[model samples]
Target: MHKYFTIFKDSYYGYFNYLWSEITTFHWENYFYGLIVVSLLVWGLEILFPWRKNQKIFRKDFWLDTFYMFFNFFLLNLIVLIFLSNATAQLFNDFLGLINLQLSDFQIVNLNALPYGLGLLVFFLVTDFVQWNTHILLHRVPFLWNFHKLHHSVTEMGFAAHLRYHWMEPIVYKSILYIPLAIIGGFDVEAVAIVHFSALTIGHLNHANLGWDYGILKYIFNNPKMHIWHHVKELPENTEYGINYGISLSVWDYIFNTHHVPYDGRDIELGFEDDHEFPLEFTDQIIYPVKKKRSKSA
Candidate 1:
């Protein structure tokens, strides 16, 4: 009994300390500020020039998405950063030591060594490319598709809808992103902050109902119109794997021949075609990806 109790105590203290460290590391104030700023900006745009003019400001699942925005941004992301990213980084460090190749030596370009603006651009382009491929793999792999389907299950696109992803998703995304970016470490904390802010703005914008056509820039950046097609029920002819997988830059999609833009929004139905049985509640949705029985039956 004493042995078991000692083991339990050690485990409890370790977890508690880890949690406190992670909580402290997180920029709570900045996160809230960004959320509030982006929310107001996108909310204003949606109300002023909504793509589906008839859609209400507080559409169906609006509150649900609100909860998801908080849950994912606050809790899920914290877990990924604290646990998954740290573990991956440690493993990578060990691997580098074994190979006698340090991370600093392999860095393609150190953002700290470059001009601030140039560093920001390089980091943004590199990270976006990494994420672009990750997004594609999630779509192509059946097991990953089951988890990623939660994001696509959003019938109504809004700013908060950008955070509507499965909890497991951030773990995979952050892990994949950490290794490559860590080795390429010119991007200091400030550069990362700038890139993250840009990502937050563009991600919310793409998921927003705002009817910003963006004209020729649609080819340059992923816009509302182009991103909407990604959620459309059916894909265009000759496109099977999926289209518009680009998160920030549309150039990747264009280069890979996965870009699809319609002449006009005709029948823009969102969400999966056969997702009628998908869970409507937040708790159920959280567990949906991990429901082994359901996956087996499907």
Candidate 2:
């Protein structure tokens, strides 16, 4: 128990220092700076292209979403995620030890044997496929959707809205992703950072006002045009969870037959049926999922 507690404490300080260094240093691999660059560049595109002509540059809840970006990205890690992830991984390792099992036993492909470039590609694809499945679980599972509802609360989408999800989301996504990625790809820090930045940029583009579908690659990667339908207030008839659950790749949705876009769908309303009554304040939204009145709206 003391060891786990120490692990948590060390993770908190370690992650804080790492984030501080990312902010202070000018490095090619800085995740913090990568966030700012992706945000501004995509916002510039929104300003230039003007997808929804009537939507202002600072659309509704713009600042709110901006705060969410910082909170979910930096502050959340500073407070909880870093320690939780570190501690959980430690505990899981202990459990695996009791059973005399190890990550090596589960390794299907040794990334070290492959060319480093192909190793990176394999890492990105495998993790992304995991996230895509996790995204579907977020919608299909009722309790999970309550937390996910805050993201769906975006009536007017923009680049910043990409990260406006519940803090519980990262815990859920990362928890589901941790083991599979570890088993398949090993812990290639360089590969992880590259995939993260790539997904972050694609996520911004997917939620931005632009309507790009990546031309012929629409079948491969996710873009704003296809992702917009994912926000529609109502899923198409007979749909259970939702459609277009892809995070960084559209191929999953297409292959799973969950893709739906009968029309342009640019002007469609966003959010669940009761979105008007949903909590808007950040604090309220954080607690909204766990409060007594969740199951009704879900």
Candidate 3:
């Protein structure tokens, strides 16, 4: 009994240590402050320069999304990322060993050896491509759609809506990207930090209800209007599945023929077309993906 208790204690303490280390190493302070400032800035802009003039400042289900933003950033994301990162790293190592191969054997160029700016550019491009593909899969795959549908359930859009995703999302998306990043192994911490910061900013902007078009550059970078169409209940004629899966760069959507923007204007009627009985409460939303229901295209 004493030996069993000792083992339990060690296991508990080890898991706690790992969790603490991950939280401390993740630069939470940066994201905490950045999110606060970004939220306030985007919220202010949306209020002052409203895109949908009829939309309310305090729209329905507003507080639920506020809870989502806090839940993801403070709890769910940190846990999922840390756990997934560790698991993926172990699985990757084992798979490589089983294949009798090494990452060094696949090396073409050392991206880290390049100049700082260029290195960051390469890292960003690689990770962004992985993310874009993952976002597409989340929509296309039937099983994955359940987890992703929570984000689309938002009828009223706002900056906080960007972080409103099912808890499993980051786990799958980041784990898939981890394989490539681990294999390449040249990206510096600073380059990754820049990529994450940029992604966070772009994500918030894409979800914001502000009224600024990016002109010709909208073809390259994702903006509010283009992304808003992504959540629209209606789609352009002849398209069945969702469009605008690009996370940061609109170029991917353009290249893949998934690019969609209304010639008329942004669609105000956003969310799944058939979501008449979707849950509004935060706890209900959290359990939504598990509930038995016929899935429909968003």
Candidate 4:
């Protein structure tokens, strides 16, 4: 009994130490590897299992998407980190204070403990749900909609289009979604890393042209079919807004009555009608909305 107890304790401590290390170490190369693999997977799946017969990929699309992806991953992220980190930190602190919540206490279970995995999974699911709801709220609220509509204006749904968001979004919206998780404390760096990769991979997969039907998987995962509907250009046609809202899981949409499935085999045109007049150049997209809003007010 004594020997068995010693073995268990050592294993538990080892796992805990590993988890702690994963949280503290930042590996840029690993992040790049993840981004490349996800992009290729999206491209390959689009070629192999396309959902829309009429949707065509072109070289211009490829280059444009690449530019947006690089810009979002590097420059936009840096801007948010520098300008919004303190604001986000304060918001998180206030939120926790409001809830009177403290960090979850980590208990030592064995290396292969079920509780550890369960805790991590729960944390991931909860965070994704929060993000999905926040995303929906941004769409529904008009002031916030001003910033978010820039994303919806993209008439294309491809790997690169994922980066076509307003600069303020990551700071204002996405930052708040992660703060609760950060405050919880027991969530280690590896879990956070896994969640980030999983969210981006599943989000890209949803944005791809893949033809796979999620079936019941739609209940748990946000597959491509469900998300494509969110990009549908027709006004009333876009009503099925609830499905596949989770960055990875679809459950949040179902739970919140936002889950939508695509019907009507015809290619639902993508992007706003007004977007046609806008310049495709990156600098123009950044300033276009602001100019339009100002013109309208005047």
Candidate 5:
């Protein structure tokens, strides 16, 4: 009991201190500043070369999405997730000790010993592949899709919309990614940070109002032109879940036969078919999925 209490208290203070450092630090790895830099850069691109010319600079639900970004990134994680995750992890570790099992046993190879460039490439590719599969589950799983709908509610996409998602989402992604990353062993922190920032930049651009395919690279990388099709309201024929489930890479979609971009999606209607009745208020949106599931089960 005392251990759980200490974990909760420590996480509360530790998370705030971490946030303060991330904001005060001037170094390249500061995620707070990195988010600001990437967001502004993408917003500039949207301003200079917007594909949706009629959409206003401050598009619909802009402030809402901005709040969702910060809330999901900082506040929600601190207020609820950190304490719970820390406690759960501690409990899991304790249970493993009882069984004389160790997580280290699952590791396969030491990635840090590899050449820097090669290790980074391998790390990026492996992580992105995990992300792509996780993204498909979010779309195909009925229970998970209830939470993921918050992201697709965007009527006018922008850079900030990239971060707008339900609070449970990071849990889903991180929980699934943990084992795969651990198995690779000794991934350099710097390499992971660089890949994270690169992916962040690409994600912002993917949701930006700029229509860019990266030409031939579109086959390898996901771009705004390809991602817009993912948010199209109507389900394409013969497919039920969704298409274009790629994250930072489009190669997986191509390999899995989930890729589909029949034409320019610049003018396509975004959001799910019944999004008209989706809650616009944050509290309502957050509670909606829970209430809906409970009602159905009853």
Candidate 6:
């Protein structure tokens, strides 16, 4: 099964490579262009088609999100890539070798056999499943939730709120969950990068305040309209949690029975009941969860 899946994944990657080459001439500049285009599209959608009326973009949140965007792209990703690449390579090689399995032995099918967009879609779906489970675990386990709760304290939900996540998240999700997937030759570096970038962009889009009809697309993918509701203050209402797990598609949520679709335009309040006393400043946000835990213990 592992070998067969790897062959399938590689075949998809090969198709993506060929299609991307044909469409844009395969220049390094074109790769950067794709990145810029995606980023700009996300920004434009946030402004033009917001999900919630109350979750308007604020200057302070915008600056913080910008800081995190730069931090993750420039520092966190680079550091994780450097530190974990070799370790991941060894881990996967050892695991597969123990089972006498190798993905390279499988033959490649025709490069153009599969749709290139499907490759991007599958990449997002698989990674989002892993991320959603990781997120649930962080919340369930007390120690990890200490850091994760800082994210939930956001009073507003918008594109920037996606970046308001705890710093520990990238470490766990990218290093542990994503690296292993990449190591088995199931996904290439480019695909993995695309998944990360697309997930962040889509997650932010889902959190934005703009209103737009996703129509049939809402059933297939996550729209900001559905995701803003995830930030609702009420517990069970807030707990409509795992719907639209994918940054690009909602297939995983549908598969896992976590998908939710709202019918009405309801006014939902954001922020945690416990977080009312805490400050939203970076330093306070960082330390408050820890202090709260300590006080509970004492």
Error of 2 at 23 (Å): 1.4
Query: What's the distance in Å from true for residue 70, model 3?
Result: 2.3
Clash pairs, candidate 1, are 110-186, 111-186
Off by over 4 Å in 5: none
The residue-by-residue lDDT of candidate 6 on 1-298, one tens digit each, is: 5754564555455545654564566544343345446556776776675555444446336776656555554444344443354445556667879889764544243222346667656555556667777766666677777777766776665565666766666666666564435433364556556665666566767766666438777767677666655555665544533233444566556677665555543456666567677666777765776787889989
TM-scores for all predictions: 0.86, 0.96, 0.85, 0.75, 0.96, 0.68
Our tally of clashes for model 4 stands at 6
Residues 1-298 of candidate 5 have per-residue lDDT tens digits of 9989999999999999999888777888787788888888999999999999999999998889888878887898788889977776687678878999776777787788888888888899999999999999999899999999999999898989999898888888877887787788867667778998999999999999999999999999999999999999997997788999989999999999999999999999899978988899999999878987998999
Tens digits of per-residue lDDT for model 1, 1-298: 5644554555455655754665556564365566777888988898888888778899878888888887787666444445545455556777889989877777676677888778788789889999999999898988888888889998888888888888878777887887677666855666677788888889899988887758888888998888888888777777776889989889999998888886665348887758787888888877877794577988
| Candidate 2 lDDT score at position 52 | 91
Q: Model 3 over residues 1-298: C-alpha lDDT tens digits?
A: 5644554555455656755675466454356665677788888888988787787898767777888887887566444555455555556666889999876766666788888788788788888889999998898887888778899998888888999998889888877886677555667666666787788888888888776558999888888888988898877787677988889999999998998776634446888867777777778777777773434333
Give the Cα lDDT of each candidate: 0.78, 0.89, 0.77, 0.65, 0.89, 0.59
- lDDT pick, better of 5 and 6: 5
Candidate 2, lDDT over the whole model: 0.89
Candidate 1, overall lDDT?
0.78
Model 4 C-alpha lDDT versus the unseen true structure: 0.65
Off by over 4 Å in 1: 1-29, 99-101, 292-298
Considering lDDT, which of the candidate structures 1 and 4 is the better prediction for this target? 1
By summed lDDT, the worst window of 10 consecutive residues in model 6 runs over 105-114
Candidate 5: residue pairs that collide: none
- CA shift of 277, model 2, Å: 1.5
Instruction: lDDT winner between 3 and 6, please give it.
Output: 3
- Model 5, residue 120: displacement in angstroms? 1.3
